[model samples]
Target: MIEPSPVKKEPIGKLISCVYRTQLKRMSRSLGEYGIGGGGQYSFLKAILMTPGTTQDQLTVKLKFDKATTARSVKQLEAAGYIKRSADPEDRRSHRLYPTPKAVEFQPVLQALLDESNARLTRDLTPEEEDQLIVLLQKLNLED
Candidate 1:
């Protein structure tokens, strides 16, 4: 009978957290070069572009961010002229988010950066290998 390897496996959560933090640091440095601070701002902008007029509460749920963090990111983006917020006509108390012309202009640049980053990260991997890795990561989500 073949014996299983005795090497102790690191907890998946810690591995993921470490990778996420490392990626975030790299992304933050890149974003800082473009005069944007690190956080959920870019993701929020992309979300707004996809669903124009999305509410703050909706962003909170979609991004899995707390209300305060979402609000601060939105406010910063708005102040930076990247987004616009207007009161919802149907619900006076609610506000809707929209990407400004500036934000729209930045979309292609941001996407190119993301594409380049992905390409760089998977430079040595074959397409099939990359796909397999993505599938395996998706399987991890199934456990949750």
Candidate 2:
């Protein structure tokens, strides 16, 4: 009897999606301790922390998030008291996102959680593999 072709491998997109789902689940669990319930808030917080004056439009493009998602998240973060928005000085209709004192305090904690998640996810990978994976992932992200 012929061996069933060793079971066809999953497509790259499916495999990457599985990895993303698992990572996000782990991140959510880790961030829960800090009152961050998933839904990509961690990313918003981190990006704002890194670039305090970033505009919502800038974030939408930088984060590759839809405008609606970005708007909703900005509202949610504001409600959570982690971010504050101000009208852009040059653009009458644009608003810039800034991290609150609370968000500043939470930055390190969020970073630690992210680092732990990354380590856990890559526990089986060698240093070289980890570097290569990150480079390849960035390449994919940068591709139009």
Candidate 3:
């Protein structure tokens, strides 16, 4: 009979992708109640809230999202009353983004939801482990 091969360790990219997909599912479910779409929509909203008058191009770069994605998220947010866009005076082609009053009022709730999501993600890890993971992830981020 032929002997079976030993199982190799999972690739780092596969593990990260799995975790990311799970996180997105959980976040999407929580954000649905607030009419926020899944897959980086909340991230865009948070950025706009934190920095008003930011242009789409700026967000595309800052958030590491494609220009098409930035445009779609901005459109959805505007339709949902979470943000507003105005033409830039110096650049007619560019539009600056601002959070609407609705989004401003909802900011605290959004933050609380994000906090809960993060807490759930790290529930299995000790404080030291979580800290170490964060450090490692930051190091990985530096590669980009």
Candidate 4:
């Protein structure tokens, strides 16, 4: 009797998409208590905290997000009292983002949660494997 054809392997893009969706869900749940919306909200907060007074336009480029996304995130963060936006001195139309005292106090907890999440993601991988995976993943240039 002929053997049945082996199941086709899932593409790398499909696997990455699945992992991305799961990661988003996990992050959303993890951050929900703090009123921090997911879909890279933590990333925006961290960047602003690290580099206070960065404008939304700069964040858009640095984070590889579009203007609308950056604007929405900034608005949500501001609404959550995690950040405040000031008019840019050099540009009337631009706003400089700054993390609020609330964000500062929560930074440690935020970092700890992020660290735990990352550790969980790579728990099964050896340190060497994790390092190698990072190197390989970084090689994938998805930029235009």
Candidate 5:
């Protein structure tokens, strides 16, 4: 009897993509529970929270997001009452991002939600493995 060839595992990119999709889905649901829109809001919120006076252009560059996406997220966040935009003092045409009190009050809880998402994803991995995974991920990011 001839033995069949051993099963081939999926490529690294495919695995990574799957994980990314699932992670986003989980985060969307988790964030929704907190009354915050999901998808791209996490990065926007974190950036605004960290730098109260960040400009839209700065946010686009820092987040590496396109102008359109940054604009849409800003509009959504503003409407959600989590953030507000004002004319930049130095640049008359540009606007600066600021977190509203609602955002500030919920910031800690939002952070915990982020932590929970990460903890859930890495629950099975040991401390050393988790550290190694983070380093490997950073290296992959640097490649891009």
Candidate 6:
């Protein structure tokens, strides 16, 4: 009978952080290759695509970003011809986000990149294993 080898453990939080940073760097490089520099801009564009007419406050909540950061991202995307903001019908003070045609046109490419990244990251995992890992990660992130 063979005894199990000692389980080597490191701080899970630090490991997760490093993984995130590395992935972010890769994403930033890819976006730069496509002439988009800001991660916030990519996220904001995704939010607009997912929820058209979303207000700045809604985007702030959905993106887990502060108001100023959300505003800046929206502004930059608008300047880049990727998005537009219109005055909210219900609240004149609020602005609703909308993806421009150019932004909508990029959706397929964006999705392809995401799928490729996922495939690369889970190269050795089966679909069920990937699903289980997602569930486990969510469980670890549970908050009251």
- Runs of candidate 2 with Cα error greater than 4 angstroms are 1-7
Model 5, 4-76: lDDT tens digits are 4588868878999898888878878878866667556778989999999999889888888789988888898
- What is the alpha-carbon RMSD of candidate 5 to the true structure? 4.9
* Per-residue lDDT over 1-144 for candidate 4, one digit per residue giving the tens place of the 0 to 100 score: 224469887888998988778887888899999999977898899999999999988999999988898889999999999999999888999888999999999999999988998899899988988998888899998887
lDDT for residue 25 in candidate 3, whole number 0-100: 90
Per-residue CA lDDT of candidate 6, range 20-127, in tens? Answer: 676667666777666555654677788889989988899888778888988888887888788888998888998888988988998888778767766877889888
What lDDT would candidate 1 get against the real structure?
0.82
C-alpha RMSD of candidate 3: 5.5
Those runs of model 1 whose alpha carbons end farther than 4 Å from true positions after fitting are: 1-7, 142-144
- How many times do residue backbones clash in model 2? 0
Instruction: Name the lDDT value of residue 10 in candidate 1.
Output: 88
C-alpha lDDT score of every prediction, in listed order: 0.82, 0.86, 0.90, 0.91, 0.85, 0.78
Model 4 / residue 21 / CA error / Å: 1.5
lDDT of 5 at 21: 81
Candidate 3, residues 1-144: lDDT per residue as tens digits? 224458887887889989888888988899998899986899999999999999999998898888899999999999999999999999999999999999999999999998999999999988988998888887785335
Clashing pairs in 6: none
- Each prediction's TM-score versus the true structure: 0.85, 0.89, 0.90, 0.90, 0.87, 0.84
Q: Residue-wise lDDT of candidate 2 within 8-117, one digit each (tens)?
A: 87887999989988887888788776677676778888999999999988888988888998888889889888999999889979988999999999888888888988
Clashing pairs in 2: none
True lDDT of residue 134, candidate 2: 83
- 93: Cα error in model 4, Å: 0.8
| Cα error, candidate 2, residue 83 (Å) | 0.4
Q: TM-score of predicted model 4?
A: 0.90
Clashing residue pair totals per candidate (backbone < 3 A): 0, 0, 0, 0, 0, 0
Between the candidate structures 5 and 6, which one is better when assessed by lDDT?
5
- Clash count for candidate 3 is 0
